[model samples]
Target: MHWHDEIETELQQMKRELKRSTNWNLDHSSDPNIEGLENVLKKLNHLTGLQGVKNEVNTLINFLKIQQLRQKKGLNVMSLTLHSVFCGSPGTGKTTVARMMGEIYRELGILSKGHLVETDRSGLVAGYLGQTAIKVDRLVESALDGVLFIDEAYALAPEGSGNDFGQEAIDTLLKRMEDYRDRLVVIVAGYSNEMSRFINTNPGLQSRFNKYFYFEDYQPEELVSIFEGICQQNDFKLLKESRKHLLAKFSELYIHRDDKFGNGRLVRNIFDQVIEKQANRLVKLPRVDRDKMMVILAEDIPD
Candidate 1:
């Protein structure tokens, strides 16, 4: 069994034992949800690379908890703006982190529902004037009481375009943000430079999005770790030589990476390709054992 599956089984057993114990009479109705929240944190922490991102999230959670305590004690509490900017390249865990933030917010009683609504330029912008506002409104309405994660948000404000509907979408989105300030959180993400420019496009965006989390690209070793974790989760084991090949492959990929590098997505794609190769090799074999089926050899590694 997987490590996580074993942990989950143990957790369930403990919960059952606690329920049966009369000495532990504390209310346990919310224990499952609390466990779920902790699980989310565990998953966040276990993500490969992004140490800086993890630290930022922890600091933000701590600050919010302290602010809540102050508010409960009738002390002056500073205004909180949960909306944020996530600047990162593709597949750097921006969307994944956004989804987790929603769950965290819901658990902390900051949002009515912990859900994520993801969109891009095409989801918000319309071809005609006045229609963009309507589209944005519907999207925002669906995202109310949750998080609206806008990927490639910079496209909402194209440069040197005086007659585009992108600006209209942005304006409408900003207005809705104001209207639902207490109920909605907006997270805009894109390439670091482009996201900075997008936030600068409007003063409101500048004021509202004070928190910024920058996700750095995964290092070569981190990429290998991620790939290995994927394999382990899928019940695949790598041969001794396959590990070396993966390390070298990831190192080369990191060295030649451009802005278009897909990071974790690239690793996943490679895994898919390698598994296909494994399948082909297994089918051609006259006889194959369970070990052979589960093991990925160096020969299966893509060139």
Candidate 2:
């Protein structure tokens, strides 16, 4: 069973603590940020499907707890922080979970302002000379008091392209992370092998992000659950027959994917296609049978 399935009690404990601390009902608010963070963590746990990865994240939550107490004491000490590197394959739910972590850090007061700014080589680095550094500087200023997540970070420094200005952007970003150490969190993500090489390229990037989180692929059962959940989310019902068919398809896809499945992203892509087929089938009927409209049949999803 997934550890996420057990987090409901922990969530309840947080709520109870919140109520006891403030008798004036201060916790009540239209806070999608809080809700979104929880959702993201839950999704992360689900996508990860690995015990080690989930355990590492538990440490992060503890860090937030300690930071919260330190702030409450009003000691004014600098908050200890880290720039983490998420090393894994694609579809490991890094982006979704990191986005939530941004909100969590904000909600817990680790950062006065918590926002997640995402970019890749193309977004932070430019095509022209001297422009990459300038753009990366602006990006840093924008994420001053928030979190900056750089996906596919290894691309910033590639082979034989020593003159590429992306390196300048990388250097500038590392320095700013230190300058605003108290206020910002930077997470660098990409494939495991490539990311290792990328980090080894610069000590500045290496020491800041001391922690590493590896996202492993999902098992067959987990992939089944993912597909079922996606179907239900899109208002498409997964019938028993269709469920079996999906399982079969997943087995075939899983083998071929090898490393391409990328955790459960392949499941999501398949989910998208199945839902689209379901929609197309319903579009032809004028008078919709509410009962049948959302049902997904084995025939609806072609191999």
Give Cα distance to truth, residue 110, candidate 1, Å. 0.6
Per-residue accuracy of model 2 over 89-204 as CA lDDT, tens digit each: 88877887677677666665556567889989888988887888789888888887678899999999997786788788888887777566666789999988889999999888
Off by over 4 Å in 1: 1-36
Positional deviation of 87 in candidate 1, in angstroms? 0.7
Model 2 segments beyond 4 Å from truth?
1-51, 67-80, 279-288
Specify the poorest-scoring 10-residue window by lDDT in model 2. Answer: 22-31
Give each model's clash number: 0, 1
Model 2 gets an lDDT of 0.74
